[model samples]
Target: MPQLPCQGCRGMCCGPVPITESELKRIRKYVRGMPLPARSKLEGQLRFFGTCIFYDQDQDKCGIHPARPAVCRAFGLHRNLVCFRMPEAASGEAWAAGEPSVGVLSADFVWNDFK
Candidate 1:
């Protein structure tokens, strides 16, 4: 069988991702000494939880990505090369219309096959 082109496909799946132990640990470490988020509805809850709790929005990337749990790290998001083409949010006043207008590009992940 042919291998799935993960690199060619950016990590843009539609749903919540699964978390793992090691990744969760890494997040705990990052949050242990960091300050609070710029905006949060769960201020006190975060104190108990630590870290961004989940993916950080501002970066348009994952806060705990490097140390993210396996399931999350293994996300097969579709890669859209043009940075500004994709809108970050999809609800309320932030709803931007349609898919990104940027051309697509493929990348190679040595570890893509590992999972």
Candidate 2:
């Protein structure tokens, strides 16, 4: 299996990043019984402070794994994996455990399912 990038730091990419109305609606269906708080910021061409409640602190995984949104499923693809990714660490312990980074997507975190 592919490893989770950025094992040295807590997953920062797990924030409920800003999303579109259609995207929000679709994901909402999956997360039933809970309000998928669409930020008031999506009214314009931009949104600020998009953060999801599903970001797991301990496991470094999305708590809402089953209902992850489209963007959440497709972030940072087809580009050179950035420098911030795969930073050096004292040990590769996190890598062995397979915990995902918060804000960044590992190359293996493909969006093919969504497409």
Candidate 3:
């Protein structure tokens, strides 16, 4: 499948990725012994518009792409569920029109299927 232009994406899909239990466990394991701020971000305690802690704004990519959560990997598989937040995508209007809402679609997809 053709990949979305996510490299320079404004991180429209980085917000509020509802991870599975196993994904959470993996994150916990990865964040264990890390600094408090990093841990808190991973735990969804320090989000800005629900953006993922691993999203590197400067690089416009996932900091932990190799070990990213299932939901993150499954992103863009369902076009209707994805909000292309690029300037030309007109994403704000799409969201206002109710484009499944962030995290809602991720919650619906089974983690095992993506894995």
What TM-score goes with each of the models? 0.35, 0.42, 0.53
Task: Identify the leading candidate in terms of lDDT.
Answer: 3
Where does model 3 exceed 4 Å of error?
33-48, 83-115
Global lDDT of each model?
A: 0.33, 0.40, 0.51
Better of 1 and 3 by TM-score: 3
Query: Where does model 1 exceed 4 Å of error?
Result: 1-15, 36-53, 77-115
lDDT of 2 by residue, 19-91 (tens): 4445444545544534434211121122124433545445555655666655555443312222245333223
Tens-digit per-residue lDDT, 1-115, candidate 3: 4456776665657765665456655654555545766444534433355565566565566755666676566555544356354333332222122222223322443222222
Candidate 1 per-residue lDDT, tens place, 9-92, comes to 233331243333443345456544355553232222221122233434344444445555443432332232112233232112
Better of 2 and 3 by TM-score: 3
How much is 112 displaced in model 1, in angstroms? 32
RMSD of 2: 11.6
